[model samples]
Target chain A: MNLQARRTGFAVAGIAIICTAYSARLVDLHVVKHEEYARLAAEKHSFRQPIQAKRGMILDRNGEILATNLPVRTIVADASHIQNPDELASLVAARLELEKEAVLEKISTGKKYIVLKRMVPDEVAVALQNELQARKLRGIYLENDSIRTYPNGAMLGHILGYLNHERNGVQGVECTMNKELAGVDGHRFIERDRTGKEIMLYRGAEAPAEHGKNVRLTIDMGLQSILESEVDAAFDKLKPETMNAVMVDPSTGEILAMVSRPAFDPNRPGDFQPSQMKNRAIIDMVEPGSTFKIVVAAGALNEGTVTPQSSIFCENGRFSYGGRTLKDHHGYGHMDVHEILVKSSNIGSAKMALMMGGEKFHEYVRRFGFGERLGIELPGEIRGLVHPPNRWDKLTITRMPMGHSIAVTPLQITMGMSVIANGGRLMAPTVVKTIEEPDGTVFRANPPRVIRDVVPKETASFIGNALVGVTQPGGTATQARVNGFEVAGKTGTAQKVSEKGGYAPGKYVVSFVGYMPAENPRFTLLVMIDDAKVDSSVNYGGIQAAPIFSRVAERAARHLDLIPTAPSVPLQTAPVVSATTPNRRL
Target chain B: MNLSFLTIRSANRIRLRPILITVAVLSVILCTALGFVSIKLSQHAVAEEIRKTERAVTRLRSENEVLLAAVTRLSSRQHLTSLVAQSKIAANYITADRVARLTPPASDEGDSATRTALNTVPSRSATR
Candidate 1:
């Protein structure tokens, strides 16, 4: 072959080899490793942007907002994109009420994402955004965020509860209904430009956020205000260690108002002690005192152990049994069941319990919804302490009759009274009325539920009539009477139980549980004051607690727009100085 | 001489036809490329507009939420109660006698002349 022809042949072969290599590489890139390279490219430019779902609002029964969300912004810094860190930091610090040095330090890190400050109000954030735009500043961005707010402050703090730093509920209905209140968050795969701005055209695979359902409570703010004001006055005037009040509709067992003194503001939960956040109504156990007399009285009547007209000798105010002598405030020769309850005679109550027998009395106590959880919507409820008949000691039967041997929650005592007020049925108490969507569509409605019937209607009516006499002129709790309404209730004056396994001397827990317009009850209220600073003479439930009940019931009646049915009675001006026979037992 | 002239002309025509076909294909390709670029630019502009609208809507929503929260705080019972106390507002619960009912209560045991007047329903024409 000629030299020119050989060179041409070599050039042609070289060109052919080059073309084949390029073709093989193209095939590998387009087919063999396509998915891997595509994924890597996507990772470089695309991100999963989380769409936060909003938490729901808590409302009162009348549609008043109790707990709600306040929209805010979280200021973030992309230090890599920052041009003038000092200027941006100064502007942010001024707008966010933060230290300029801290913000500057954060922006100088050269990190891709740095949180400069959180919880910046919307107005301030908007102002800062405008200022940034005006100055052509970059890197600093505002992200959407929110905070839980309780507009009523500490008014219904215990019932509404508060959120923690992580936005989880810590107590009360907030904890119990958290699943319904916290919504499902969504996300989308979005591509961003080199400047860290999202490319809206390249957005893909999105799921819309599902916001939380609103929780409407059964509480009426008007009634809650009345109860809180009255309880606050009692807490100040009496200077008690602790005070609690709970008002419920006896017909439906809906909690209208519940308040505890020393309450912490939910907006600032960190400032208060854990004790201040306790809902004592369902948590604190106390010896129910004479308020428990209704249990024995009702049991005796329902069990046919004693008729309403049956008379029992009071041992002339002193009765000795099981190597102990039980006493009453005043000596009485003979009294019927009605007079026994009217006087709150410890001796008379003990005699009735003896007639009913220990097992039967315990059954009645359980039937009245004691010794178990009443299944309220609030968190951290205790079942209270009630000894079975087998656990009773020699004097347990007698001592338990007058509320000395067993401990019970304030809620139990209130529900026990509701057995009579609600015509023998024990209704399960609930604070939640309904769960609704953001658009006011109800997701779930909590209807009234009856747990069981404690006694017959006739029996309940009889016991109710007897309780009415308790607030009459000669009854133990005459001060509990509301003008133009028949107040049916019982007084409890239990000596404060000591942490060292005995009664605390010179200290008492007084309470009054009552319902007004006794013929047709509207609400059942409970007022309990623990260790009032008043003199022992004026520390009885009739004096310290019943008067508060009167004030609250009167205000609640006015709010409920209940017409006056009974004849107006004269108000008691001075405390009735009557001594309740103190029962001293272990 | 005639055959020679015809052959040359035919050869010229063949060259001219290939040139025309190349020009037509190039023009079509250029037009298609321009059209694709124009469509992409339009899409980008629309996307930018959508992004701006979305940002504005988000900002407005946030502002609305802020206003709602403020309104709730101002009208809360605690705030109103404090206001009443501070300003000495005469906000008292109306007595039962002052409340006019749509339907008068069945029993008139405690009804006075003022209560009767309050309880009595107004005629529809009068109400209108």
Candidate 2:
């Protein structure tokens, strides 16, 4: 073989080895290491950032803004990028009202990122940024944030609810309508320059945020104010353990105003006890006393077992049934159904129930919306305790008719009276009127919904007339009458149930449930006071709760613009000033 | 014989180098001038558009924030109550007897217009 031929063979062998190595490297780069390299490249240049959607506003029926958001910023520091840690720390401490030493320690750590302050107002944030830019500072940054604000302070706290740190609703209407209020957040992937400014030309895969829809409630701010003022006054004066008042339009089941004492401000809910946060108007249960009489009277009349003029012997106000004796506040002879309600004769009511039987009477109780949730647009509503006839003891029938043995929420009692006020139809209560989009387009509307017709119009009218007698000169709740109007109402003075089981000693829960203009019912209102501080002898519902209802109804009637159906009766000289209804023995 | 001799002399002697050089220099100057003017015009147009858009965004944002702040202040129950208490506004309620209406002929009991008005009519403060 020649020397030139040997050299050419060696060169060809070397070239073949080099080509094989190159092909292997190409496969590794394109397949095995591709994902890792691509991820690293993306991390170096592009960033995924969230575009936050604005939380919705809450408004009243008249479009008054109840809850809103104020734009703010969160201040952050990149310790590694800070040129002069001391100067930056001092600047932040002065501007943000932070501890100087803490700020210094945070900025000196040489970390990639650190949160310096949160929820800085937009104006302050802008001012601080301007000063920093003027001084040619780096490392410090501001990110968009927001804070929830309730401008009404504590007025509608329970109804409006509050938001958590993550802007999620935690209670009340906010919790019930959270999904609609939270809206859909969007995102974008974009390349940022070295200065942390987004390069718009390199923006990738962007989506715009969908803002939360607005919620319009059925609450009337004016009526709410009136109710709050009157209830607050009563709460302050009576110093009750708990106070609850609810006002509803009988014609439509719209809740005009609702208030419960021991309320916490939603803006500062953290400062209140868990007990104070309970919306007791719909959550707490109590025996409704004589207010439950209307159900039996209406039931008997509707069932054709009795009429408005039907007579029943009262057994001289003391009756025995199921081995237990039932008594009334007064000993009476025979009384008509109208007289039974006016005198709040417990024995009369019980005898009437006995005539109607337990099963039929229980059906009426359920039909009047007791023992079940009213399905208001609120959270944590409870179906109150109502024992079915099968679960009832031998004495349950007689006792249940006079509002013992049965537990009911204040809202239920109000709605029960509304059954007569609205002419025998039971309505589903609603708090929210409409759900609106950001552009004022209505997404959903809540119109009046009739649950069922509990009785005929004639029966309701007869009951309404009897209820009016309850607030007349000789009736149980004469104090509940508003000047120049025929007020129809019932007074309830129930012995509270003891936490240790039986009836509590010397503790009473008193209430007044009523509607005005006996001919044309407008609003049905309920005021309940539990464990009032006054003497037990003066703590009857007609004495304690009726006057409060009267004041509230007067203000409410004036606010509602209801025309006087009856000639103006002379205003009584402060009905609460006198103890009209003695705490009679039962 | 003399014409041929003259033509050869002219061809060998004088060249037009100065005229060609002048034309080339003039063409280069004109092209440079045109390019500078075109670049400056584009820059001005882009800068103006950026300014206009920035101004528009700023104005809209300012208006939105102002309206928001105003509404927040006005609708506040606390503020309104304070105003009423201080007699800055008259919101005292009118009783049913104080109101006298020109009753419409043959109105029914269910007529909404005959119902009590919930809103207050402004009354002068006694102290004021």
Candidate 3:
């Protein structure tokens, strides 16, 4: 071959080899490692941005907001992107009410993600963002966040619980209805620019958040305020270990007002002890004292063991049974069922319970919603301690009739009186009224529920009339009478049950459970004072708790706009004293 | 006889038609590419505008919520109660007798001074 032709052939072969090598490399990249490289590129540019759902608000029956969300921001910094750390830190510290040195220490770490401060107010965060933008600063961002706030502070704290750091409810209605209050969060696939700003053009698939539903409670803030003020005054004056008050609509079993002393502010739950967070109305168990007498009295009448006119002879204040002597506050002769209840005769109640068998009396007790949880919507409700007939000893029948052997919650005592006020039906107590969507559309409503009838209507009316005599001039609880209204109630002065054994000396749990306008009952109220540090003589339920009941009932009546059905009585003037200082009176 | 003359004429002629067609096709391709780029840039600008609008709306909504929460806090029953106790406002509960009810009591036989309504029955003059 010629020399020129040989050189041309060699150049053509070199070009062919280069083309073949390029084809093989293209195949490897397009087929073999395509998925791997694509995934790496996506990870570098795209991320899943979470969209937070707002927590629901708690509202009173009249549409007053109780618990609500205060919109906040979580200030974050990208330390790696921060150019002027000192200026950025100073601005953030001033806007967030934080220390500049601490913020500087955080930004100096050179980390990509740093939380400068959480729960910064929305206004403050906006101001900081504007400042940063005007100065052309980068790296600082505001994350959407919120905090649960109870505007009423410690008022109704026990019923409207608080949330934890993870934004989960820790107690009260918040805990019980958490599923309804916490809506499902959503997310979207998003791409960001080199500056971490979302590239809205490259946004991918997204699902919008489903916000939580609002919860409306049955509580009336008017009635609640009245109850709380009265209870607060009593707690201050009496200086009891604990005090509880609950008001309910007798016909519907709707809880109108409930207050427990030693309450913690839900907004600052961390600052209080666990004891103060207890909802004592449903959680704390105490002897129902003479309030339990209505059970045996009603049972005797219903079971035909004793007529309303049936007379039982009292042993003149003291009676011996099962090797124990039971004494009344005063000596009494023969008294009928009405007189026995009006005078709060322990011996008379025991006699009536004896007339009815133990099993029958126990049945009546359970029928009155005792020994069982009333199924309130609040969390941590207890059934309270009540032994069956088989568990009772010789003295159990006698003592249980007068509320000595068994324990019951203050709520149970109020509901037991409701049986009379509601004409024998024991209605299930409820706090939540309705669950509503964000747009004020009701999603679910809780209607009043009737559990069962404890007695006939005639028997309930008879018992109710007898209870009215309890607040009359000659009765034991005259102080419980409301002006221009007939108050039917019972006074219970129970000796506190000691941890060691029997009753504690000179320490009492005094309570008055009643309903006003006895003929057509409006509400059933209970005022309970535990371990009131007063003289034993002045610590009786009729003397101490009944007066509180009277004040609360009067105010509640006025709030309800109920006109006077009877003549007003003369107001009594009594000395107010702090029970802690027994010798000082106001 | 004239075949050689025809062949020489064809070979010497300039190919103006093919050159003109190729130039036209190249120009069309370049203009289409430029148009696609312009459309993409416009879409980016619109998306950026949309993103700014969304951010503004979110900020405004957040501000509204903050103000609402403040209003709720200030108007809460607890706050009002404290204000009343401090005597910041002169508020009082009207006595029952002073509250003139639209409907008279079912029975108005009690103390006339403490009656809920000023008149037990509707006046004929007012009704007329």
Candidate 4:
């Protein structure tokens, strides 16, 4: 055979082989890739799934909700689906109370999705949906959404804080417990026609959302509301620039209610001043005034420098120190350590403070949890300022005894007083109690905590006795007493120091710190009214602040089922016995 | 030779190879389709149960809201004040309008008895 003929035969054979391979490859591509194509198509119809967890609820000891989420309706829009933006916006605005301009602005840009309005009423939402259909307003929509409702409105506004856009908590416990409060979001992969109506119930990939965990708080809703109402009334009557109050279990350090006035409703925070959003009970600091005398008296007893039997000569109602004149409420000539507090005698307190000196006074103050944060779960906590002994002058030492020349937040002062009422122990005040899973399942719980022991037990009794004396017939805070329960506390009326460190006259911070059932103290309450013009310039804690303390304490005692104190007797006044002169009775 | 060839041709024409190949292909395709459908149906049942559970959660939340509202109403501060006023409980300390001038002579005798009676009577702070 010729070489050319053989080469022609081999070329034909090679061409035939190549053609068969190409045909087989085409068949494989058409048939074998079917599953992949189907998967891609299914993916196009699927919606993104969000994790949704059952949010925890805040409950009272009795299981009342302080904060909880509710099912609500919202307005959603698909910009692409809207054929006429103007028509859709007009109908939605009238139904949802949103401005047409706003609604149109959201979808006019032809974005795929937009929210027109949130938290619409169920009835109004239904009507809006009906209107959308009736008017043929394409893409104007309503959808089911969840909203958080604080049943006790504005009761624990600062503690509960609130959620904003994207369901993120902004402040307070809501923000602090965002992890527990925020449920996982969910997605639905339903098959919808071009008109967006459901064709098949579901035809795409889906993963159900797991709901968020629920959080239960330690707050009692009834107690919270009671405190809130009382504070509100006091705010109206006293008209303080700002006011705050705290009630705590002295023994347990469990914070019952800590309310700061001029508060905003978390459900609608827009109506209030943003500055008022801070929880002044734990954040704002001012010279605590004479109510702080309880700390000094407790310190004196702890140091064994004085006792109820100890006596001192009050400087005839007037004594001078550090180029400043100190005055006593009464001309308590020769009085016992208890008398000094009962009468709020500044002269005696100063003389005793001189004996205490800067080092001892500063030490006691630090021990009382001053100059330290409470480490509460809430945010924006400020550690009140307590200048070190090195920073104190002779005047500061004297003034510090009576709640001046130093700064402390209202909450810290209450906690300090609680040490005396609770037999020398201080607790870490808590607002949250527990975290729970869906269907009332407890996941994490917070137990009552003892922060530390601030003083000796015997010293606490000595201070408690003197505090009780203040509510006696002629004491400085008789009005703070509960009828059935013995009330032990002190009154504070301090002149606000101006920016220049001078007394800003006529501006006063009036407050009262007291404990009920003085014999067996359960709760210690502190009421602080800032810039209080008591009784139309009523700065006296006995007259203005003490009354609120009385109402709150009495009611709280009864509500908590505490043992009431023995009634006060109109006993004959006892004559003065001891006449010790210039003793450190304060 | 012609008769034998005709007989052989008739037998070859009735050969079953092509029919068997067609049946085998059809059966494999149908079985694959059935398996795919069975898997989808089982997943659908699971998805439906999840939907039911989600609806149950929504229903429970609404029920809780109603109960919370009831509690709020009963414990309202205003309600307590009205109850207190209606009950007319007497105070433990009956302070006179004037503190400094009050004499010990004005205190009620047998104060302990009055307190016992007040405790028994739930109408007011003090038993009338």
Candidate 5:
């Protein structure tokens, strides 16, 4: 071949080799490395974001909001994007109520993510965002957040518990009904461009969050405030170590108002101790004192062991049984059942218990819902101690009848009286009224639950009439009387149990449990003052607790608008004993 | 004769090339303009709708928050009690004497005032 022909052939061969190599590289990129490249692209643009659900609100029976959420923003920073760390830090510090130096230190680190402040309210966050935009600043980002707020502060702290950092209920009804209150959270797949702006066109795969359900409690804030005010006054005036009160509607077993002193605010529970956070109405166990006498009286009436007119001979204020001397406040002769209760004759009650055997008395005690948990909706209830018949010593029968050698919660004592006030039925106490949906639909409603009938109507009325005498002129709790209403109640003065296992000297747990307008009872209220700082002689329930009961009952009657069933008489005050004088029982 | 016809056909084909190229250029220009306008119009419509939705959401949220704040302030027991303490609100308690009986008397035996007080019935609305 000639020289020109050979050169042409070489050029064609070089072109063919280049074409083959390009085809091979295209095949590898399109087939072998496709998945890895696709994943990297997605990571650069798209992210999975969690849509947070709003927690439920807690409301009172009157539709007053108790616990609610305040919308807030969590300010986050991208340190790497910050151009002027000092300026950003100062602006954030002023707007978010944070330390400037700390914010500066955090932003100076070339990290991508830093949290500047959490729970900045909506207004503050809006102001900060506007300032950043106008000044052409960068690095700060706002994410949605919320804070749990109790509008009434410490008013219902024990019942409507507070939440923790993760928005989980930590105590009280909040913890018990957490699942119903906390709604389901949703998720979404979203894409953002290089400018960190959401690309609406590329948004995909979203599920909207279901907001939490609202909880409406049976608590009436009006009644609650009344109870709290009275209890506060008592706590201040009597100077008790700890005081608690519970008020329940006997007809329905609905807890209207319950309060305990030294309460911690649920909004800021971190500052309080566990002891102060306890719902003492259901948790604290105390010897019911003379309030337990109603149980024996009801049992004797229901069991046909005693008639309302039957007279029992008293031991003249002192009776020796099982090496222990049982004594009444005063000497008495033969008195009927009503007279025995009016004067709180301890020997008479012990005799009635003796008439009914220990086993029968224990049965009556159980039937009144004592020595067992009342099963209220609030968490951490305790079944108080009631010794079984087999466990009772010879002295147990007498002591138990007089509210000794037994333990019961304040809720139990109030409910035991309810059996008498409601005309012969035991009711299961309830705090929750209804569960509501976000759209104001009631998801579930609680109705009155009747546990069982403990006695006949006639029997309850007979005992109720006797309890009415308790607040009369010659009775023990005369201070419990309201001007236009017939108050039926019992006064208990229990010697405080010592830490070493015997009765404490000069210390008493005094209480008055009662109902007003005795013909048609409205509420059964229990006011318990533990360890009042007074002379033991004047530290009786009739003196300290009954007066408070009267004050609260008077206000409650007006609030409830219950018509006067009895004629209005001249208001009379209980005989005042000077604080300096040695105390004496009625 | 065949050679002459071949020369004439070749000359006609060369003359028609510029006309065909002009038509093709015009078509390309028209198509590009129409597509650009359509896409711009669509993007503007979508952005406007998005802005409208955002404003609605913001307004509803603001109203809801305002109502909630008002309810919270008014219904709060602490606030109302404070009002009562300051005498800004009336917590009136009607005495038995103020209440007049609507029903006929049950008995005329006791003191007339006492009988009237016992017969008066409270309105249920007042209680709630």
Candidate 6:
């Protein structure tokens, strides 16, 4: 059996030798060919993406594009891959109107990918592509990208704001609501060539970008245009240090227009100071002048301390009260309540305040929402100085009544006037109307947040009628009278306080606050000409501010389409001759 | 013992069975390796198919961009206004509003950059 054992050993060795060779081949595939196997495995997990979603738009109330993302093209070139570099450069230079040398310089390199152009229009990109393809040129490429575009230009610039070069919102609503305005970026999952070109891999997988939400502002574009144009004129003609205008729906407090002069184009917001970039309607605070008189008048009428027919006795041209001389525009012998506003009698106004008493007068100013923020949804606001009754100075009680010893912002004064105009309910001013989601979801700010009923509707109406006399034939602001509408207005000439110390010597704050269709007001406009033209003859708020108020009021009243109530009222007084109230040697 | 033919034949047959079994095992090990190689080659071909499709998609995209640009240029307001004057399609000089995408109409928000249909396109916006 030794012969049989030897044969068995030989057969077993032969089988072992064959199995070793086969196992070596398998090891070569798993280890020696590891790179190839890994590559093959990766092929299962590749993807490509196309057509990134467009960023959402900013539309006006009527679907006009206040802001939009226009489709732009980025031209790129694979310099190494190019077949005829000169031909591609020539086409790009010709179509893009670029310097031939510049185009040549870009394609001269051996780099596979080079930026030929950026922010190109889709049309230009397609043209370049077509030109290249027709010639079978290989290197040139085009990528579709988007750039933020503002269609209205500088119409509502600061309020609308703009995106920077990196597509970042930097100011205005665009900055404040940037999270909603900017879209989430997404990428194509395609296999890239060594030079970063998307390879000829199969369409594998994709995660599309989530587009941003569209924002529609409360501003009416037409009204915005009107306010912009008017404000521009005021700055040019009047040439004030600064001018601001805000028009809001008194009933709802929805801001129809909020315009500040010295506006910069949002397309290049970086070129200006932060002050020029602010929406002054919400941010800036100025001495309210005589406009604050509405709050005091409305309160006194509401408290039953004064009636529509309540009269005041003026102490000739100047009356000494509270260790101060209360002056009048002229030496009025005896003026009635309505005539007091017509004459802008400081003495009569102080006397009326005295009748209301210091405590009640202070309560009226606070209740009218003065001496505090108007509660508008914006970044910066100022709480104007009213010296809460407990902090009144020796002369504060009397002087505050004549529109002094107090400071107020344009926004605060506007809200206070709105209370009287909107039948005694003080509405909170609002700039933003609504916010929308990408999935067509909408959230609105539509709350009628009343601060307080500072005055009765009847009293407010009575005060409004008295205001009309100020724009009558022989009134303080006669120039503010509209041809069709009986204007209710007040003229104010207050000495501007210096920034360093006390009141400036020569500079004056000449202004007028008025509402059109006097009997039933629809719009309240406040026009102030700070440090206005003060010549020897014509130096009063009636001359400088009243005319601007009238121009703006006439245009606004006609545009608003409000019919005049008393168009044929009989003329009871002479034509306005003098607004000379500053003759008092202070 | 004399030469016994039955015992010798039994021993040879046992040795022959082991030798045949060894050959059969060797043949299967080599054949299975060859089969694995063939399947791997097929997988490589399927992967190449994806690569080829991606190249085709790239070419198509480039072509789409070319066509879109051609359409924009051919219908551009500047091109059409030049066409109208040079071609003399209309009898008299055209108003700016008659041009394509160049001017806004008499009414509505007729800005220069507003979107325009063929009807809204001004045939002549050139002040020349």
lDDT of 3 by residue, A236-311 (tens): 7888889999999999999999999888899999898899999999999999899999999999999999997788
Candidate 1 total steric clashes: 0
Instruction: TM-score chain B for all models.
Output: 0.63, 0.42, 0.61, 0.41, 0.45, 0.47
- Top-DockQ structure, candidate number: 1
After superposition, which runs of candidate 6 have C-alpha atoms over 4 Å from their true positions?
A1-55, A77-114, A186-188, A193-205, A270-278, A307-310, A332-337, A354-360, A377-379, A436-449, A534-539, A568-586, B1-128
Better of 4 and 6 by DockQ: 4
lDDT of 4 at B119: 52
Angstrom error at residue A214, model 4: 2.8
Clashes of each: 0, 8, 0, 30, 2, 13
Angstrom error at residue A288, model 6: 1.5
Error of 6 at A313 (Å): 3.5
> Residue-wise lDDT of candidate 4 within A34-80, one digit each (tens)?
68876687778754433344466666666766666665566788887
Instruction: List candidate 2 stretches off by more than 4 Å.
Output: A1-40, A575-586, B1-70, B86-91, B105-128
Specify the poorest-scoring 10-residue window by lDDT in model 1 chain A. Answer: A577-586
Count clashing pairs, candidate 4.
30
Per-residue alpha-carbon lDDT of candidate 2 for residues A1-586, written as tens digits (9 for 90 to 100) = 6888989988998998899899899889888999998778877888887888888889999998888877778999987678878888888899999998999998888886799999887778778988988988888988777777888887877788888877889888888899999899988887765665555556678898898999999899888888888877767666777888998988889998899887888888888887887888888989998899999999999998887778889989778877878887889999999999999999889888989998999999999999999899898888899999999998988889889999999999999999999999999998999999998999999999999999999999999999999988889888888887999989999999999999999889999999887788888899999887777888899988898899988887787787767776775565443323343210
Model 5: per-residue Cα lDDT at residue A184: 90
Provide the TM-score of the second chain in candidate 6.
0.47
List, residue by residue over B6-59, the lDDT tens digit for candidate 5: 675566555567777887888788888888888877876786588568646854
Q: Identify the runs in model 5 with alpha carbons over 4 angstroms from their true place.
A: A1-44, A84-86, A575-586, B1-52, B55-63, B83-128
Alpha-carbon interface RMSD for all candidates, in angstroms? 0.7, 3.9, 0.8, 4.8, 2.5, 7.5
Q: Residue A278 in model 4: shift from native, Å?
A: 3.3
> What lDDT does candidate 5 reach at residue A393?
85
If both were scored by lDDT, which would come out higher, candidate 3 or candidate 4?
3
Query: How far does residue A14 in candidate 4 sit from its true spot (Å)?
Result: 7.8
Better of 2 and 3 by TM-score: 3
